[model samples]
Target: MLGANASKNSTLTLVFLAALKGVVGFYSGSSVLIADAVHTSLDIFASFAVWVGLKLSLKDSAEKFPYGYYKADNLVSLFVSIIILFSGVELVREALLNITNPVGMKLQGIALGTAVFSVITMYGLSKYKARVGRLIDSQALIADAIHSYTDVFSSLIVVITIVGSMLGIKWLDSVGVLVISLMIFKLGTGIARDSVLTLMDAWLDKDSITRIRQNVGSIQGVKTVGEIRLRKSGLVVFGEIEIEIEGDTNLKRVDMLSEEIEKIVKNEVKNLEHLVVNAKPGKMSVMKIAVPVLMQEGLHSKVSGHFGRAPYFIFIELEDGKIKSWDISENPASDLEKKRGMKTTEFLKNRGVNVLIVGEIGEGPFHMLRDSFVKMLQMPEVVEDVEKVVEKVSELSTLTAPTE
Candidate 1:
């Protein structure tokens, strides 16, 4: 959306300036000014190319283009590059012909004013487009910006040639055209190179990859990170990660760990989306543990003192010494009701909760919970924090050992 808007704005500015320059250049009989005006005219077409690219690129993924239509932008950028290259070659050919015929020019004040205006206007538009391109990471916008900026340099040369015409330098005007044509040709090649690189699916920024690795690796039960694959969907990047788990864990535990890692990575990495995660576990089964909590803080959420009366439960599905998917669910049984403790115990068992960590519990509910294979642990005195509670759970697994 932003790219299309910027391109439209560029087109408006170029149209106005090119018209003004054309009238002045034709009347003043300055060939260099005329060529510069032609350059500005071609810019309108280039800006339109960029706008077309951005529009087509906005299409969503379909059966045909499962990856969406991001390549439309790149394809258009390459097309514009070809246009610029051919335009430069033609301009240079015409300039050589114009140079051979060297016509005298009158010092039209309007021509000088128009040249100055073009330089200033193009300079401002170039800056605007460049800033927008950087903000959105739109390669097409950046390429267009470079094209506009090069026009500013060419306009300055046109101004110089106009000054020379006033001082009896007849051939200097054609020389200006010669220089502008060569510079335009050079810029065209550069833009084409960048566009081709994007079409080839070049690697993304290194910092983004690093963030994905660090964030995913930090998730509990992710023993090591491997084979992080990335692809760009316009400015956004999607990744597929392969992770190895530390101990023998069931598929259920591995699945939870994958979801947990995806959440963590999405939270940490900017403009990154994880499409898939694969976890391979070592030789150990994870113990499903539940910790009663007063509330969920997302990251630093603490455990609660009361087992059945807590407002929420911080459930940890642990594999080996690591925690995966520390989920939080509201404790409906915590509400005042008859046999709420028994209700809590029943709730824990039905939900596959194997272990409960509590600061306090009643004998009736405690005994009932154990009958369902749901073990109980006294919450460590130092386990007031999330990290400490995780440590306590890790300790619980070692103490009780794995049953499955």
Candidate 2:
């Protein structure tokens, strides 16, 4: 609403300036001033078009246009570009004709004053529009602001042309018009390129996608971040992402995880209007198992009865029902008297341990590991050797079976 109102007010101001310049240009016979008036008149139409585009873009999604009317802003920008291009071509033709048949103009004081006023007014208006456009992230309004800035330059040229005519340099007026026409062409081409790219549904920049991926991967349940697809509609962005999760994850947890990912991405990327999270099962070709042991011995260490108080943890990597590798490390949290089990659970999780073989576990750690999607297997008896534990895990069920 603020953006639309700003554009509306600016259009009104342009209308006044255009009328003032037109009246004085004809009275003083200043061709450059008349060309500037034409440009300002087109600015009025462009500002109004921007205002309308902002209003239409704010419309909610409907049955007919499920993606909403956000593209209206881009369409308006493209239309404004075409108008500017047309005006530039016309001004160029007029400038060429004037250059061939140079006419001296009677430089009136009112014409010079009007050109000066336009220069100051357009400079201020361009700054105002640019501030508002950035605040609202409106492309149409920003393009309109650029249009206003061009007017400032063109009006300056008009001022120069009027002063040159006062100094008896009549040909400078035609050259000034030619310069403004070229500037209009440059502005139109830039706006047209940007608007057309947006209309073509160009993807978001790489930095934004990378930031989103890093944020999503930080979520606990996400195993891998997949393709991130994002597109912009005016100031808003829409996208979907694919994330790989545990195969045994429940539907309720999946929903929660999806919501978490969406929240993170929204916070990471500005103007993200909508995001869809697609969760899929990750490949389970290998299993990582953690076993609490009495000592930091290889496969010869005896499995400890108490999980949290154990001095060492044996990490085993099993691939395709065969033991691939194993490592043993001292449990740093075993010396802690309070919340040791919970800390141990966190330690194992950070190591990417998906399965825990235990003789006994405290209630806190049991629930925490379970919630973290770690498969807990009960050790029937105190196992003396770590190798026997691997055989036992393989015999009970397939390594890929979901935790009960």
Candidate 3:
């Protein structure tokens, strides 16, 4: 985008230069010099077209153009080239006719001086434009740079013609015009070809594709870069890529993969815009393991036991071999005593303790604990025997909860 703006500025500057040249050329009465001035003047229009193209290209995607209006930039560039080509051809034809029949038009010293001035000014602008174009990957700026380069060539030829005419070879003036015209025509063709390719939605270079494939495939859990499709609309490189990975992967893992691929493409490639990542499962079967959670209540410990406290926290191991704490609590404790019980579970959960073993909990507390899917080990005192209670609670039947 910065490149586009800079290109617009450069074109505007060229337009001012052309206007100044045209005004001076008209009063100077040098037909050959005036034609060059007119060509430079058209550059102003070309620059305006480029500005419009750049503005449209930067538009966000919409229903009218789902990929945005980037193609407009190409159209503007193509139009500019055509204008330049015609201008050059016309100037050359006129110069040829003038040389065939001597005309009574006096070459003005100011015309030669203007041509020299234009060369110096446009040469700097062309270099600056090309530098910015390369930095921003802007095709319009590049095209403008090409146009400005032609301006330099034309100016130099005009200056040489004026010098030659003063040295008694009047025909050299006509020859200079023809040379500058040919140079303009050649540049116009190159710009036209480049613009046409861009408008045609040409794919990015092979090197870019290779880099994309390598970068995406290098991501963790990405088995291979299945396919990559790219399109350049104006300055943006819109792309869609497929990645193969292990089958039945969870949403979180897939999301991570997508993010990784996007980051790599954006950072590595200039002017990357929209990206679509299609994740495909590999042709291998893999086991789905349940992440384990430890439960406990005060001094009691259970690998998979239920807690009677509400708003309890759960601790689980992450894939990176690090422990993470998750608050499974939905409802805060209704009473002070219940709050204390909740805090106890939190402390234990934070410390990597798993299950809480309790029975006959309050309705709110019980619902909270059960909602987390913790293993509920229920036991009742049998004939006032604490040993029987412990035995019943320790039994594995109907105590363990199913893994998610």
Candidate 4:
């Protein structure tokens, strides 16, 4: 926001000063001074260009420019620099011509006072603009300020040279133009260089990148930082990051982590417009492992007693003295046990234990078992004992169809 304000302020200042200088130079018949005034006036166009660039670059990301137009600011800076460069070259040409062909100046107290006033205003304005540019990190605005500062200093030179001429020191006025031209040329080069760097899409300094990594890596659930990329259009910055996390974590967790990273990056990096995160799951070292004996619960006592082996069927009697269902296969050592790796439904059928007492199960196998009519005790974990689980199922069974 400050960046936008700086551009606005620069545009207004440039136009005002340019017009003032032009009027004064034209009436005084100082071609060199008039040239400088016109040069300053041109800043109005450059300032407007910067304003447009800053505004457009801040637009939200779209399909055409996924990263938004933040680079437009850089282009604005380049244009501003070019404007200064052209002005400098033109001023230098005028100064050389004036040196060759002497022009008499009609110096007066009023003219000197006006020049002094212009000098004061230009310097004061440039100083304020420079400070504002620094505050907002605006290269184009800073360039504009430098342009104003040159005008102020050159105005002073023009005044001093004109006064010296009134005192019969004729060569001093031409010398003043040369001095002013040199200053303008130096500032022009700086603006040009900064603009070029922006156009090239250069990354923020290394320190900034490192700081972003540290801030993002500090987020919870983020194990490491893989890639962090940065780009700028006008006043906006776009960032891309790859974060590392545990493999087993779900999508919801990843989304939360991404939001956190975005917040951190935005807080640390000013003018950040868009942040994109790519989550890379941490690799799992152990793919599969076997565990010791598993416990069984919520089954009939008689059914439990047949765990060793027999005709494969065992009836677990309920607490109400009513038998719920039978487990046809009880022996894990039976010949049918050799086909163990089969799906749960197929394995249970071969075991002859058509009924099962277990906790919640998923749809695929549960529906398969229902089709077999292998009456199941869909027990809730609230049941303390295995028998209780079976009883709950038996209690609900009459309301539903029985399995074959």
Candidate of highest TM-score: 2
- TM-score, structure 3 vs. true: 0.66
Instruction: Look at candidate 2 and tell me the lDDT of residue 279.
Output: 84
Tens digit per residue, CA lDDT, model 1, 262-316: 7766665445644687777543367677778767885378777787788987777
Cα distance off (Å), candidate 4, residue 398: 36
Task: Write one digit per residue (lDDT tens) for candidate 3, span 1-404.
Answer: 66667667876777777776777767766665667767777777777777788888888889989878888877878887898798788768767876886433354577677778888998998888889878877787788778878778777766766666667566766777787788888888988887887778777477878987887777756777887887777777888998877433446557877888888888766788889888876643222111112332311322222332333333332332222323332323323464654544344433533234343344444434433323344444232322233333335233333222
Between candidates 3 and 4, the one scoring higher on TM-score is 3
Q: List the candidates' TM-scores in order.
A: 0.64, 0.83, 0.66, 0.63
Residue-level lDDT of model 4, residues 224-279, one tens digit each, is 89988876656567788987774334465667777788888887777677888888
lDDT of each: 0.74, 0.82, 0.63, 0.62
lDDT of 1 at 156: 81
Q: After superposition, how far is residue 29 of candidate 1 from its true place, in Å?
A: 1.2
> If the candidates were sorted by their TM-score against the true structure, best first, what order would they fall in?
2, 3, 1, 4
Off by over 4 Å in 1: 94-98, 170-186, 204-211, 247-270, 282-404
lDDT of 2 at 366: 73
